[model samples]
Target: MKKYLIKKILSNNVVLVEKNKKNYVLVGKGIGFGKKKGDFLEDPKEIEEKFISLEGLSDFEYEHFLETTDPKIIEICNKIFEMASSELKENLNPKIHAGLIDHVNLAIKRLKEGIEIVNPFLFETKLLYPVEFELAEKAVSILKENLEITIPEAEIGFLALHLYGGRGNNDKEDALKHSKMMNRILGHVGKKLEIDMDKYPFDCQRLIMHLRGVINRVEKNQSLERSFVSKLKDEFSYEFKIAYDISKIMEKALKIRVPESEMGYIALHLHRLNSYKH
Candidate 1:
């Protein structure tokens, strides 16, 4: 049973749950609508177990049990709860909070076992990358059913905060400023890591979202900024110079421009490292 904290009760047995008040998805069940906000959805484990001992169960029944009543789904729900508790933003709109938590919970379930991602700087989500709520919802659905990988919604905000500050801070006015920052880091990663930033497994669509949001200041963005380049040089430890040098390779393969913003991104990581030293 996926234990959800109900956010809103829709008519016709459809209810929305705010898993961590970050992401929301609709739950359609007979009992879902009656549950009040902050109430936990009944555990699916008991329901699943009841179906297991039955003989000659119909395929449809078993499919439904696997989808909705599996114990493993409950375990995934719990893991998502942990991530939401640790990573969620404070003071979120209830709808957004619910969506984010639900998204994370579902995402962990989708990941293929032993899918190793090697990024010192950020958590790489393998799912469809979304720019807004509508896109996120649509992507979440596609990912939940089809793909076994997904990106968490708040990762962009977290990376932004790491490089700059809080959501309430420079996010509104500082556009080009961040573009420069991400470009540097991308450049660094391209140069130093065995991981390919442009090819599959580490494909273009995902990287583009990270680039425009975390490093560059672009609206309707689809590529990296200059700042990401700088991150590799100053903050990479032994990985710094190697990652810093790879900007040229990325630029050539991806046909993306690396500007002053990349320099700024590099500087921010360097500054952070320097501060940590003293």
Candidate 2:
């Protein structure tokens, strides 16, 4: 790759570069030091942090972001996206660039100012978006290493939300609501049955997978009739009752009625988990 010129300085570490007649935004510590427009970097190869802009498209948000946001913050978020892309093997939505930069900037500012906020859906976020949560964890570590800032765990949850929005199909807020309901239902089952959910990883995973599918079905209004629901209820009364309790919570949390078949499937999972000795 040929070295690019400094077309403009967006920040102390961020600069606009042109290569092969396409514009790119480069971010690195001191990459833009004492540089002016039309001044080519002696080693553009040294600019390891950069994102290519969509060809011939005017991304006003990205442009405004480069001008207004801190380059260090942008650099941090870029590493996160790079990590996510590498791990997930998918191209994240470029639209997330500006939004994530803005979020990181504000998050850092709030942390430096000693203001803290809690994420009510933190647990749910971890369970629901495991991969994204991992990326967020790495992002926090990077911030600590580069900026010497210890971000709150709640911010990691928030960053996971941003990553989920950037990669997944569900609306970020709706996904959080769904995950919260699922966790609440699982918690209720464990309490009612007096079972240690951690002891039965397979059963727990099964329940989570079932509930995830249930959410999709419910959102699509796809009704599934369960002919064996009554039989299962009679055979496993305890698990059936726990399932009923979970159904109520889901109904309340999701504001959608859960079908008996769905409850029956969930009860089967609960039965298996409760029956396990460990």
Candidate 3:
């Protein structure tokens, strides 16, 4: 039996322990209560509800997170991770630990300050990642229960994105980058149309989902049929022009050329959006 020695106590529920020359962060209820440095912990597996291996993780970032973030927030994140792991039935990327804690802490702060950010990709996210979205709904419930605050629906989308990114073998950065690019493109669309996209949530969601499909097709070098291109270009010249400009934006951002066939599809969506403005 390997004996675990406490290296440091992050909070009442979190402690850094050393076993067999390996360091791990142990998390559970009162795992660190009355614990001191160099204290030996017997049967760590019996007591620890969650254990995070520090291997290949940035020490400075972990230390900074522990030093700066609220312990209550950390505890909540642990619970979220536990629930996610059980529901997902797989190991999540460890990188999400800091990201989730930071995001939740900031979200709570923003909500308290009455600063709410509208998530433009909410509909697309929920539609694409149904499992993660469901998990995010539960996560919001946990947040509401523990913090005694009402989390907005928009936050659920953000949480869903995080949960989707944290899933096994998924790159968190890529998930975030995809959403960010969509936001930029939507911002440009709103600017070009000279209308607030938020006011037309359904139309905006349709446009976002269309863009997501376009991006997927573009990345895969897949081409849509060109049968409607001429008709769309001739019938909705203004929307087609805006869609062309959006193609240029996508080309620059994704480093992939947008096919003209796909541009027609985008124009079709834009034409619908244009009607909503009337």
Instruction: Kindly list the per-residue Cα lDDT of model 1 for residues 91-190, writing each as its tens digit.
Output: 2222222223333434354444544333332323222212222333343444355434554544443322222221234331243233344445454555
Off by over 4 Å in 3: 20-22, 33-35, 42-49, 53-57, 106-134, 149-158, 191-196, 276-278
Taking the candidates one at a time, how many backbone clashes does each contain?
50, 0, 0
> Rank by lDDT, descending?
3, 2, 1
- Decide which is better by TM-score, 1 or 3: 3
lDDT of residue 167 for candidate 1: 23
Off by over 4 Å in 2: 1-8, 16-49, 52-68, 194-203, 217-225, 251-257, 275-278
Ranking by TM-score: 3, 2, 1
Best model number under lDDT: 3
For model 1, the run of ten residues with the poorest summed lDDT: 47-56
What is the lDDT for 38 in model 1?
Answer: 75
Task: Please give, for residues 138-216, the per-residue lDDT of candidate 2 as tens digits.
Answer: 8889888889878889988988888887784646677677767866876787788887666665667668777778878
lDDT of 3 at 107: 87
User: TM per model?
Assistant: 0.26, 0.72, 0.78
